[model samples]
Target: MILGYFFILGNTNCTAQSLPFLPDELTQVLESGLPKTLPSPAETGRFKKLPAGDGFVWLAESTATLKKGNKLAFSKTFDAPLKEDDVGFVAVRCRIVDADNNANEPRPGRVLIHIGDRETLRQTALYHKGTIGREWGWYFHPFRAARSLAANTGRIRLSFDVQPQRVEIEDVRLYVAPSGFDMSRLPMMEAGYQGREPDAPWRQGADARIAKYRTAPLIVRVLDPHGSTIQQADVRIRMRRHAFGFGSTFQVRLVDDISPDAIRYRQTFEELFHALVPVPALIPQHTPHAKDGNYANQLLSDLTNTLHWAHDRRLPMRG
Candidate 1:
């Protein structure tokens, strides 16, 4: 079927996929069809309802009829092979009944999930219901596959471990992650200002210190089998400029433009990096106060312009 143009199909009521830009390889992986599960009501069974069905069986729990641990556990196995360039995610649906409810406030226990053997606190999903009631409310958690398991070759296993708190779980499921999955932020290192300026006051010879490292060549050596150096090795070097500057989130740039009078100075990263527009002007401002903030308004304007410039070319900022 032709994309971006209306076309008629043989009464099949075909609808265009939401993400038409997905890579063809990834699209093929999705088109392979998802594993089928029966619809609700018709799909009801002992295992479907939980605690009874063998299908949604518990893998581990803190306390059981025989022995109690600090938490409850459940797991399911499925065959979903992943190929290169294919992204994956997991969606889990279950109900959690926390035993600790004080005056309608739930000090619900935590739920941990593991896709395959890779697990981290980032994969945690909550099981607390706000009201003090006996209704078994369902919670749906979606997780993106970690880089290690994004591509795979074997049965996919999803395991859930709940911290000790009087809790009961039901209606557990594991499946391929779908688009628009709300994955939590992966662990990240905060960016920092690293250059002579930030250290100038404390560094006795800051310029010399900066030059010492700046002038150091990123050397590449060529050698032969006997460990003899190749004297005339042709080499080409491409180096990125070392920079020290503050970076802000794109959301901060969405504010209304600042008054021109608030700007103290204007500068551009022009040569340091490719820019789509004039760099924002710098203004003197302080914490929680935009009036006296430095570059407070200019930064916003610059970001907005930069976004427009990139959008015009249909290019992403990272790209």
Candidate 2:
């Protein structure tokens, strides 16, 4: 399968331009305000610090093979103190290779981030292309530390838990943003793969299928009371609902509630959805006290009221 990757920074004002490609070891840090040097993991057969020829460094694992459930980790005090409520974003540029070259699919790994004593974030590291000679890909994970950080000072730890296949790691870096910083606005690299091409054979087939199945002809005829077609007339069509359902599960208790917030909730639900599924209140497990006469009667009353409310508004409900 053909595979490629592109780095996309979400900057609305800047014009699009091509960026020069750099080797994995020399990948530039895209975000500003990052520390000059991040603390590196100690050298080992499975993990080592490699120099980039420039002053920069790379934490790499190139020698020993890893097995499932194997853990590799390191800790370091930040160059500066980390304050409470600060947001941390970690960017890792790495790749995994199938050391045995016998696997049918990509392997998966987990990366965990710890600030002080509490585990702050956990993200999956999917080795989508694990074959030999595959290019490296970048992954970004973000987390926030809300509690007090007086004890840990600037200390942080990172752990990589291996899956069923052997893997390699090329680099890891952390950037600390101010509290309430929006992670979605950060620059990110977009990943591309074979089937995503606009003119791919599979895409052409999909387009043809969509055109054949998802479209229909609509003809309008305006008629008079005498059963004759009107030559000059205005015909307007307004769609009330979609042929496809768009909805979500809603709490049944909210249907009978008279509080202002509940009223707004029900109104918004009706405005947005053409159908819904009543949640826990109608589920069998939630009615465990069915043997109690009074409890059963109350539940039946609430359910009946909810059904009436839905019927009055012409809302279709599933259970």
Candidate 3:
């Protein structure tokens, strides 16, 4: 299977995406001063204390087990009165770990989210990669309106119908979109080589092309803070080539792991692929590495080809 991905470099007033999982780590890579529209688990104050008044804080990655027919449930009521802004959309994150000797693979489990007396929605907490021994992944559930529920005292509940097995529940929290909030206004990310679901088709196409060809020419026109284009500008470009392997199945995963180990690999690529790298003296013609070029002439050629291609396709190629 052929995999693809791309990065975006544009001038626009855009914020970063709200990645609840270690957002601080992501923020380091992302731009600053960007708004995080998603509400935090602390904002809800649902897991503040225990009912027994023992001052036990309900932590994430809590463990639980269930028989084949048994169902496990957990719920939280909103402390502050719900406002008009909390009515449109709702999202939450959940994870489940399977521990059992009888099964070699993971199975699908049932997840029910109770919005209120009127809405009791049902969804599946699918295993990671559809396998059974150990599974972990992000689970985002979207709902229509929390306003109706908020109108009636403002409370939310979550339920899990566990399959016959040992399951460990991870951190879970709910969020409601602001009033008159439009999802389209949300900041967008360039769908990388291995994009998650709910991707923008236009971006996906552009990203796919960049991934396959492994190169694209972009004319960087600098602009003042007031949006005026500057004639003289010094621009820099960063390019990186990635290699991913898949053996078990023909399904190609882009392997966009951003862990600490992968950081060094990414950094090496960034350094090697720096567009401003001076030409090496080894080659008489100043030829760059054909595999991943850094020579000025090679870059100019790529830019020329890109401009010609864009012109042929009637795509705007602004200088």
Per-residue alpha-carbon lDDT of model 2 for 1-319, expressed as tens digits?
A: 1122353211111111322232232212123222355434422224544444553433334233354323455444444434544555555555444332353433233344554532432221111221111335545544444333542344445554323333344545556665455543454344334334455457877888878997788998888999899997988898887787777777676777777767998889988887877765577734535234444565666777777887887778886
Q: Over the stretch 146-253, how does candidate 3's per-residue lDDT look in tens digits?
A: 223434344444444333333333334445555444433222223222223355346878888877796556778789999999887877776433242111210001
Model 2 scores worst on lDDT over the 10 consecutive residues at 7-16
Please provide, for model 1 over 217-293, each residue's C-alpha lDDT reduced to its tens digit, 9 standing for 90 to 100. Answer: 56688899999999999888775533443233222243233534122111232233332222223322211233333
The numbered model that scores best in lDDT is 2
The clash count for each model shown is 20, 0, 7
Ranking by lDDT: 2, 3, 1
Candidate 1: lDDT of 15?
Answer: 21
lDDT of each: 0.34, 0.48, 0.34
lDDT, residue 278, candidate 3? 20
lDDT of 3 at 176: 50
Candidate 3 Cα lDDT to native: 0.34
